[model samples]
Target: MTSALILENLCKSFGSGADAVQVLDHVALDLPQGQSLALTGDSGSGKSTLLHICAGLEPFDRGKVVLAGHDITQNDDAAGAALRRDTIGLVFQQFNLIPSLTVAANLAFQARLAGRHDPDFTTELARRLGIAQLMSRYPEQLSGGQQQRVAIGRCLAARPRLVLADEPTGNLDEATGDAVLDLMMELAAQAGTALLLVTHSTRLAQRCDSRVHLRAGKLQVPA
Candidate 1:
């Protein structure tokens, strides 16, 4: 089967000359459709940098990023933005929901941007995330877990082929975090969306189909 996401010899750097700092050094990875992979590492180990590169949010100095059969690594900014809007979904630890938008509006935001808004799907996701009753509420009115659910729901509403999560459960209590992770995995599986999750929790990483460790800018197969 064709991979849902692939990265080949990925390399990224920041600064220049004497100040140059390499974040990714010839990193490579692939995730088949419907597969889930967890990325774990210490602070500044390139986990988030790799995630950003995969999501087309950051440019790589050298490498290829193919998502859902499109090689978007070299696409122009506009093309990359379009590709990301159409094929990629990202969830961050901060639950970056718009404060002025209601839960339902936030859930529909990405879908609207992608021009693939499906009322039925958004409604179902809201219900599944247990935010249906709070659809009219603003982000500020909800708890941290509730806001994160809305964030997840917003991503799912886009029906993205690949989902990138960065420390998605990092802000929640243990019970809430587990519950959210479970819901995310279940939903991603049901949608056949490949998931690349960067997390620090060993238990969470173990729940994925594969676990990888990143250290000193290199990735290793979990022992």
Candidate 2:
């Protein structure tokens, strides 16, 4: 299977020289299309940093990052932005929905940005995510779970080759989080989009196709 994301000998740090703090060290990962991998680590372990680098939102000190066949390292700012818009989807714990837009518009936001907007597909996603009835509602008008379902629908509506989610279920109750994850994974599978998820929940991690724990900026099998 082709890989949607690839990282090789990745390294990142803050500051410089003796004052520098290494957040990621020789970190490497590969996520194939249509599969899911969970990333687990303690706070400040650089899991989110890794996801940002893969999305071309952040730069690595030394490494190669390829997203859906494009080597992002070689892309300039505008090129990287375009590549990210076209090939990557992002979901965050905060449910970054545009408050000004209704649920229907929010769901179609990313897709429209990528020029992949399909009215039929967007409507299908809204129905599948159980947010069809909430489309006319604004983000603030919906509950946490409802907003998150809209967020997920927005991410997948772009038909991105990969989805990089950082602690995507952190704000919801356990049951709600689980249900949200179930919908996320199901939707990802249906769209054939690879998923790389960051979470601290062992139960949630186990639900993915594979799990890797980040320790001291390196990945290892979960103990």
Candidate 3:
């Protein structure tokens, strides 16, 4: 089967010379379509860096990153941005919703940007995420969990082939987090989107189809 995301011998560094920080060192991973994998690691363990690279939000110093048959690792800014807008969805821990936009509008933002807006699908996602009632409100008016639901809805609105989530539930309470994650997983499965989620919760990691741990800037399958 073709991989939805493939990273081969990935390496990334920040800054220069003595001040440079190496976040990923020859890391490699492959995630097939419709599968979900949890990436777990301590703070600054390169988990978020890996997600950024895979999502085309950041560039890797070396190695290849292929998403849905497109080699995005070496693309120029415009090309990479286009690929990301068309093929990748990202959910961050900060719930990066536009503060001024209404919930419904925020959910539809990316889809509209990608020229793939589908009101019907956005409505369904809102309903499934239990955020239909909050659609008229702005991000500040909603609770953390509600904001997260909106974020997830926004990512799913485009029905992109790959979803990259970074600490998606880190700010929510246990019950709310579990409920939101359940909905996310269900929707991701239904959409057949490959999910790469960076998380710290072992229970959450165990619930995914596979789990990978980042240590010393390399990925290892958990035993």
Best by TM-score: 3
TM-score of each: 0.93, 0.93, 0.94
Extract clashing residue pairs from model 3: none
**Model 3 residue 122 lDDT?**
94
Report the lDDT tens digits of candidate 1 across residue range 1-223.
Answer: 7699998999888999999988888888889999999999998888888988888877889888899988985588899889989989999777889999999999999999999899998998888777899999999999887888889889889988899999887767888788778877887889898999999999999999999898777889988
**lDDT (Cα, tens digit) per residue for candidate 2, span 1-223:** 9999988999999999999989999988889999999999999888888888888877789989988888888989999989989989998777889999999999999999999999998998888777899989999999887887888889989988899998887867888678778878987899888999999889899999999999998899876
Error in Å for residue 28 of model 3: 0.6
TM-score of 2: 0.93
**Each candidate: what lDDT?**
0.88, 0.89, 0.89
- Give stretches of model 1 more than 4 Å off: none
Once superposed on the true structure, which residue ranges of model 2 sit more than 4 Å away at CA? none
